[model samples]
Target: MNLYKLGKFLCTVIFYPLYRIKVIGKENIPKDGPVIICSNHISNFDPPVVGITSDRNIYFMAKEELFKNKFFGGILKRVHAFPIKRGMRDRNALRQGLNVLKENHALGLFPEGTRQKNGEVGKGLAGAGFFALRSEATIVPCAIIGPYQKFKPLKVVYGEPIDMTSFRQEKASAQVVTDRIMEEIRQLHKNHR
Candidate 1:
């Protein structure tokens, strides 16, 4: 097991029970192959919450700033978390993400790009859609509802996977594809909200 998997397992064992996490639709996750787990960004804790609840290991694209600290960078590296330069369209980050999906690993993407205090689903960036189309990966829509207060039960809902084969054939623009993916995430949150 990789460091991230080990760390995630340890954290899940230690914190999930204490936090009273309640994950729903976990089976909605694909059993194998590459998939893009698109979710709403509500808090800094969202990534780990979804990561632990997921049956498969998920590699997340974290902002480059998070790796500034040497200690934290080492830990993130173990979990397969990589840094992405926010804004200005970082092609290198996108390339790295594609490699992960090609390897049949789950890639976690927060369409909002950053944590939103209001929990509103902002316009999702084109990266997720682009990667899905490029890698021919399924897009799994996910929503994490409720504040992650200590000992409070949190809800995580994973929706059915959306196939991108059609989108690829249509030669859909990144914005169009991204909007479609974001709508799925929005609907998931709306239902649970």
Candidate 2:
């Protein structure tokens, strides 16, 4: 098996027993197509949990800092994660994200832009919105409940794809689209509560 799947298998072996992970709305995810899985950023473990929970191979848009350490960077690379400089509009990162969609692969990212460990839903960056509208890819809002710690009942809920197709023609700002995405995530988190 490829490193991505291998890593996922190993994670499942560990996550299943440790957290007793629960996933909802798997049926909402399209089996095949370019999709943007956007979720709230709570912890470093959030990405792996969100990615592995889905059946699709997820290519994550991780922060650039995660690549600074060679050893950890190698692991990130093996898991199909690319770096994105947070807090600024990084064109190259955006291009790479769009390319992932153009290739019809799943692109995973945190709309919140950075980790908010407290589990509070915060403002999201427009990157996910830009990718969805530009690539016409479906945006799947995911909500991860509970902490990433062992013995906690971690849950991940994948919401229905947010259709941004109609806004393609209009000049919708990134912030506006991001607001809508964050709202969906909040709703998912609320439903799980």
Candidate 3:
């Protein structure tokens, strides 16, 4: 019962029921070990939606601006959400993400970069792919269907893990690996729909 898990539990108890959330494939999540949970970004609430449904601490890469607010930042920190500069390659953010994986922690990365209102899956950033290749951690592809509005039961479908060990040995290009990861996520979305 660490602070992160506790906060996530509280969030699940409070918000999940109110939203009538229905999470599928909870068993798909690895019971333990370092892993990257890649998902699609729809709304601002998507992060918390995944967090509450997860049984482990999910280190989420949120935009740096979100940390500017003292009150909100405090809460975000409690739930293991960290800041990442939005456009361009932010080395600092990348290092932080790698450290989370090295420490045998779970991370949440939305490959689409930012939220898409059009509901189209966008290109994924190379950050998560790089981390997966370097750490040789498993990559879990997940999909979130529906909005986070009141009475709208958000659906989350978690897919089986994608092993990254081969990528690590072959030293795959970040773009190539990221594209593969994104394609898997897209497939998961299509299957769920």
Top model number, TM-score: 2
Off by over 4 Å in 3: 1-3
What's the lDDT for all of these models?
0.86, 0.86, 0.83
For each candidate in turn, the TM-score is 0.94, 0.95, 0.91
Can you write out model 3's per-residue Cα lDDT over 98-180, one digit (the tens) per residue? Answer: 88888889999998888988765678888778877878567888888776678767778888888777787789988778888
Which ranges in model 1 have alpha carbons more than 4 Å from their true place? none
Candidate 1 residue lDDT tens string, 27-81: 9898899888999888888888888999888999999998999999888877779
Using lDDT as the measure, the top candidate is 2
Q: For residues 76-151, could you state the per-residue lDDT of candidate 2 as single tens digits?
A: 9888898888778888888888888998899998888878878878998777778867886888999988877788
Residue 48 C-alpha lDDT in model 3: 83
**Between which residue pairs do clashes occur in model 2?**
none
Candidate 2 overall Cα lDDT vs. reference? 0.86
